[model samples]
Target: MTGPLLQTHALRAHYGDFQALFGVDIALSQGETVAIIGANGAGKTTLLRSIAGVLRNEPGAVRFDGADIGALAADAVVKLGLTMVPEGRRLFPSLSVEENLLIGAQGRKAPGYWTLKTVYALFPILAEKRRVPGTSLSGGQQQMVAIGRALMSNPRVLLCDELSLGLAPVVIRDIYAALPQIRDSGASVIVVEQDIGQAMKVADRVYCLMEGRVTLSGPPADLSRDAIHDAYFGTAA
Candidate 1:
């Protein structure tokens, strides 16, 4: 619970022979929210995938709770209290919203506070639509299910990829509004966002990645828009 809850040291990844990530170092403290912002192909998702155990690496690459998890499988990672709300709101088309949420708790190795009731309370509309198929909900509602499902696992660290991708402005606001509650539920968050502004609004600290390497990192307040812009695009101009 102290020091870094999750960390990566000289982490690298490959899709077959093409390495998408160079040596990367990152850290997340307990209860902190950090944002990963970069353009398309800047290796943002690759980084998340690597940490979530979706991509395997050499030992000592990915660490959680001070233990290396680089070679662990995805389910093993989840059991260790790290879960991801993947991009595209990948809800089960056959599962009802409630069913989807329930599955997140299956095989959880550690005790956690999140449950179906609190998830419904956080997103009240979900309580009303619990019986509906998760995929039938609107994009925003589906995203809610995806998030609720992840929370049901009661992860200590939550990795969210593109939470606002295709949602409307108001819907996006509604989702971001729930972040404090998510934090209160005892999970450090790493939100991967294409929109730096949204990331800045929600993150305690920000890291900008470009071409597989970290370009800039600091408190959102300390890193100016101009600085972020330069790091994001690889030039001050």
Candidate 2:
């Protein structure tokens, strides 16, 4: 196996004294897609936030590309080639479709496989709506813009939080259809999702979380439906 591109060791996080993450340790290697699956309030988002530097952890708690980034600020993390497609497809409503994508490349430096033209190629619908306001597009289109915006950053590791929420199955498929291309662009990914089947489809490995702790983790084919159900709901059927 390749060396880890990102890692956490005894990582803990909190929202003003209420602990949300309980010493979670996970790793992602270069060019691998790992999924963090769980129900609501399982601290999956917290884990992502911690890694992205939105929620602070002790120095050396989180490491990326052989260096410690736990104490770095969010923008600093982005500058170091780590970016997140946050939940809810948070785009700048006032910005045009093209403008939203450009913002993602603001702090980027390294020459990468993702650029405005390349991103447009990945989501051709966005190319057609290039001049439209980001919010003016439909929900599925907005989600496409969100993912594309993240791609513009040319990150070494992409952290996605709930990419399938609040979308039709067809729209979800449309969004996931881009994952293969995303992997080809030379960025590993960590997807935090509630959609088990969808996660299984795209992830090389899966980590099941419940109440801020890792319950089950392995290759998707190695995990049985019964085991996943138990890990997700905390009960066996």
Candidate 3:
């Protein structure tokens, strides 16, 4: 790869003594979408956290846009154009819809595409509920806000942790529908998902992790069903 927008070279993360990621290496090109799929405790969230600078790694381990950001704090990483939409739709209950979205732009430096008006355009329902508290919206709506908030940063790389976590299938479909537009904004995306079908739908490539390590990875169409099953569950069908 010629200077990937984001690259993790033998990245590892730990919470005190409990290690989460084990020499996980991944890369994302500009405007590409990669999905990371695995069962619970596969370290998907840890990878995202590491990349977004929520968790520290060894120096020179995580390079974003050719800069070493492994030691940067989460806020500093966001300023460098990397952001994550956490697994749960963690929106502020006291903040209104628009307020929550604006908060995402707080540390923004590089200008790409997303903005308050563009976010509203992406999710019209948000415009209608601009005055409502973020938590007052329906589950599906809250998820939309989370995605929109991440976009508000105008990131070069967007890390989405479980975009379809608890929503209905129809809502999931609606959320996935916006992915193409997101990619069109010139931002690479990393989606961590348990729903294989949904992940394959939006991803150009997929990586399967097991017990804190990557066990399988390839283009979605090239990965066999059996391989995916094994990687997801750590067993053959």
What does the lDDT read for residue 21 in candidate 1? 87
- lDDT to native, each model: 0.92, 0.92, 0.91
Worst 10 residues of 1 by lDDT: 105-114
Q: Lowest summed lDDT over 10 consecutive residues: which window, candidate 3?
A: 104-113
All candidates' TM-scores? 0.97, 0.97, 0.97
* Positional deviation of residue 222's Cα in model 2 after best superposition, in angstroms: 1.1
| lDDT, candidate 3, 12-51, per-residue tens | 8899999988899898888889999999989999999999
Query: Candidate 3: misplaced stretches above 4 Å?
Result: none
Report the error of model 3 at residue 61, Å: 1.4
lDDT of 3: 0.91
A best-first ranking of the candidates according to their lDDT comes to 2, 1, 3
Quote the RMSD, in angstroms, for model 1: 1.3
User: 1 or 2: which has the higher lDDT?
Assistant: 2
lDDT of candidate 1 over 1-237, digit per residue (tens): 567988999988888888888998999999999999999998999999999999988899999998999999999999988999999988889999999998888847456678888999999999999999999999999999999989998999999999999999999999999999999988999999998889999999999999999999999999987889899998944
User: Against the true structure, candidate 1 has what lDDT?
Assistant: 0.92
